[model samples]
Target: MQAPINIALVGNPNSGKSSLFNALTGLNQKVSNFPGVTVDKKTGIAHISPSLKANVIDLPGTYSLYPKSADEYVTYEVLINPANADKPDIILIIADASNLKRNLLFCSQIIDLKVPVIIALTMMDLARKKGVEIDLAGLERELGVPVVAINPRRNKGMAELKKNIELVVKEKHAPARDFIDSNVLAPDAIREIKTYFPSRSDYAALHVAVNSEELPFLNDGQKQGIKQALQEHHFNKTKVQAEEIMQRYARIKHIMKASVVETDPLQKQLRSEKIDDLLLHRFWGYAILLVVMFLLFQSIFWLASYPMDWIEGGFGALSGWLSQVLPDNKISDLFINGIIAGLGGIAVFVPQIMILFGLITVLEDTGYMSRISFLTDRLMRQVGLNGKSVMPLISGVACAVPAIMATRTIENRKERLITIMVTPLMSCSARLPIYTVMIALVIPDNRVLGILSLQGLVMMGLYLLGFFMAIFIAAIMKMLVKMKEKSYFIMELPVYRAPRWKNVGTTMVEKAKIFITDAGKVIMVISVILWFLASYGPSSKMDPVHEKYEKLIVEHPDQSEELNKAFQSEKLANSYAGILGHAIEPAIRPLGFDWKIGIALITSFAAREVFVGTMATLYSVGETPEDNDATLRQKMSAATWPDGRPVYDLATGLSLMLFYAFAMQCMSTLAIVKRETKSWKLPAVQFVYMTALAYICSFIAYILFK
Candidate 1:
């Protein structure tokens, strides 16, 4: 059996750290939560050689060893704690070749641990294209570590990287570097502390004496001992730590100057910067962003309709067949109405979700997302949020679960909290079905300026409404939650490169799979429950009516078969489900909702998309038509209230759409929030507030229109 060598991959954000991990591990990676924290832990297995298999751990991205947030703390803890199961036998410090100075800050800290460290110089191609020539041999000599250039996206230099890893493991070569020493304690105290510091520990005990306050798990005694040592040594730990970081950058710069060559001065001036000059311009940048968002909304609405129709049609056919084959019983009705209807509801929106995520992934892979952050920074600061909040806010449009998780990168406690609080307000793709159906029913299908559709304009308005609300809510929270830390925005903007299709596809597939599996189970269960409720009724009341209708059909032998079928439909619906619908009819009457619509709304609490599925099931249960459209749309159009008013009029549909837009209808989202916030209070508050707001908005819309 081969012994597994543990290798740690570390890098700055956007240094292709994730891409490199994906390339190394491929399908071998597993994503988990870092123990007791929401931060993601990614681990995988990579074969360095035929004889050498490695367990690779990809640490959270950090600029330096000095930690700021919980996510950043994970990076520091893993590096500092040798007892961690995932601790690396060899550390591969990855650096972007183009931004060597900034990337090397963390690299130098890793090297100081005296670990068997190697430099994986990523993005070397991008650096060379801009007239920058890195002398690999000279860089290796200066850093006293083997350096291998790799383009993880293209699988370039991977062979050389693997060869170096094999050699390092065989030779057990450790990089030599200057380590920090804090002589703050008395000689006797220093000797006592040294006993606890093992040779295998990466950093010296003195380094801990200086940096321990910045760590996450230090107790009172450990903190006091470190403080006393610093006091005795007459050292200001904060200043010393800052100096160490700055010195490392300076050293990296000096080494780069000696080992690297610049070829084309103008090559650095890429189209991205030129585009950013206008796109990130304080004035036009925001305007352009808004216009781009408008286009995205329009695209989503127009592109998703065909696939949605197909999904609706497919499920309608399945349910129709199931209703015919299953014995006329509650279980049959539950399968047709509940499970099929509910799953169909969410499945219909998959296309829209995929398209939206595809666009987002493209923007991120091509490095445009960083520019979005840069453009929004000043404006975001005014709202008491950091620019990093913009990414989460944008992601919220797809779903708030990932959006909330994405806030780990923001660093500021108050800002991250504010971001999470306001994120769900952004119109997620789950709400798209509701919006699209309503908008199509209410808004005119005319074209404005011979380009923009009127329906598209209304959709754009809803998206803008959500965005502005998030900003306003965040600003209000900023004033309410007072904190001492000054908000700062510092980010690395990667050079523009062609979007990597492989990366984008992988991300889209992974996200889609998670969304389907996570939410699918809940929706299916709710659908079945709803089906049962809607199918069965009080047998004493329903059986007599059902028997009478069957007797009438048998007596009217000359009557058309279609007429008998319609009579049977009326009698069956009048059963338990119909009576239940009538029972709740009074409550929803004010909102222009019939008992059937009420059932749909109640079922949709499992997920917003279930509304359509519920409607489809309810409509299909009544009678089968020639085709889905003729059956669904026509039946829906002909639906009437008790007073002979239309159930699904333009006004009621629009009101329903607005309701779903603002409602916290997703149980999965709430569960995720509970996990991420580590408290039921936050999600509880969110659910109550959003649900109340949605109810009020929907009620007003319905009343005013009626």
Candidate 2:
């Protein structure tokens, strides 16, 4: 048996490193958290040969070894610490072919670490299309490393790449160059800094001593040594280091010019910029974005309605059939009302969620999202956020849980916190069901402009309302929280390309599976518990009424069996759940919610989509003799309060929509926030603040409408 070799994949941002990893590993990968950190640790196994396999790790993308934030710290720590279980046997450095100068800086730093390194020239297809030509053998000789030009997207040159990895792993090949000492500072100063921080990687430590403003969690001796080094160098350390980076680039450019060729400059077009001019223009860009967003929301509601209705009706019929087939028993009731109804409720929205995420994935993959971020940067900065927040904010429309998690990429603490805080305000897919049901109930479905539905227009208004509120809240928080560090945004705008359907399909399937499986368990349990609560009553007080109703139904010679049974069930629910609903009626009356809506609200706290399921179960319990739409809707529409007032008027439906829009009704989101922030305090604060806001907003809306 051959021993497995360890390969580390390292690269700059947007260098196609991840795409290569996905290609090499191809479903053999697993994403796990690092031992003590929340940062994702992605690992996979690749078969190098029949007798040999290799372990591959995809390190986080960073420009340099010097770390500024937690995510970058993971890259630095993993490379520097050999004792880490997954330490690399060989480093595969991926460099963007189009930006060789910037990419080579990281390559130079990696080679200096004395690790066996291989350079994978990514984006070679783009480079070729741009009329850039390279003498691969001569370039390898100049860099003193084996280099392979790979177009990972096209699956070109992968066979050669894998063969090279095997040769290096089996010790059939040797590195083209050995480590050379290149001290960026005076020798004595470097020694002193090293003495104080013995375990720190030398090059990274030197970079930090020169560039970082303040080093947190450093000892007094280390700090003093760094300060002394800076003073003795008699130069601004950062400026000197920047000059060194520039010098390295100059050397790389000289080498490339000797060994590379440009066949035609015209072929190297600025297509990305041309597209951005229109897609991200100051005026047209934002207008296009708004129009696209409006269309997305409209499609989500309109396209999903047919499927959603089918799911609802099918589940209702299935439950009715099960109730009729099974013997009248508690177990049958649990299966029919608890498990089936609960699971169906959550599953009904899967189509809408999938469609929304699929569209987002397409937008992101095409590199259009970055342009939006670039265009929105100035506005976001004014609100104390970097343009990077734009992605999370937009993604919040699919779900806030992942959007909040995505904030981990933002380096600024204040900006990231504000992004996390305001993300939930963007209407997520979970809120869509509540919004759709309520809007359908209250808003007319007339068309405007001969194309747009009035319902769609209102939905668009609510989404925009959420977005503007996010900006306003972020601006206010910017004033409230102060930090001295000046921050700027820099991002890669990859050339536009058609979406990869394979990648999009994989992402959509994975995300949908996670949502259904993870949230499904909780929904099922809550449904069963709620079913029992609404079905069974206080035995001592309700048993007599139930028995009397049962006896009265038996004695009715003219009544059909189904009608009698429905009457008995309705009487039983009224005995317990109904009483509870009335108990809370006065408290909710000001918000225009009656007992049934209050019951749905209470049940939906576990998950927002439970509103539909709760209604199904409640109505199922109160089934009538005819059991037709006219009967059910009429009963629901005419449901009366103790004072004989109707339950679901336009004002009440509007209030419900507003309430769901603002409420922190998702347990999963709260859990994820706690996990991401690593504290109960943030999630707790969010729950309290959002719930209070929901109450106040709903209350005001209801009052004004009344």
On TM-score, the leading prediction is: 1
Q: 377 in model 1: Cα distance from truth in Å?
A: 2.5
lDDT of each: 0.76, 0.76
Q: Lowest lDDT 10-mer window, candidate 2?
A: 625-634
Per-candidate total of colliding backbone pairs: 5, 0
lDDT (10s digit) by residue, model 1, range 52-139: 8999899988888777777788887887776677778899888989877777777877877777998999987778767789899998
Q: Residues 321-392, candidate 2, lDDT per residue (tens digit)? A: 676677877787677666776666677777777777787888878888777788889989999998989888
lDDT, candidate 2, at 502: 89
Query: Which pairs clash inside model 1?
Result: 131-263, 184-233, 338-527, 338-528, 537-576
Model 1: residues >4 Å from true position, as ranges?
Answer: 177-192, 196-204, 211-235, 263-268, 315-343, 547-587, 624-635
Instruction: After the best TM-score superposition of candidate 2, give how far the Cα of residue 343 lies from its true spot, in angstroms.
Output: 2.6
Question: What is residue 621's positional error in candidate 2, in angstroms?
Answer: 3.8
lDDT of 2: 0.76
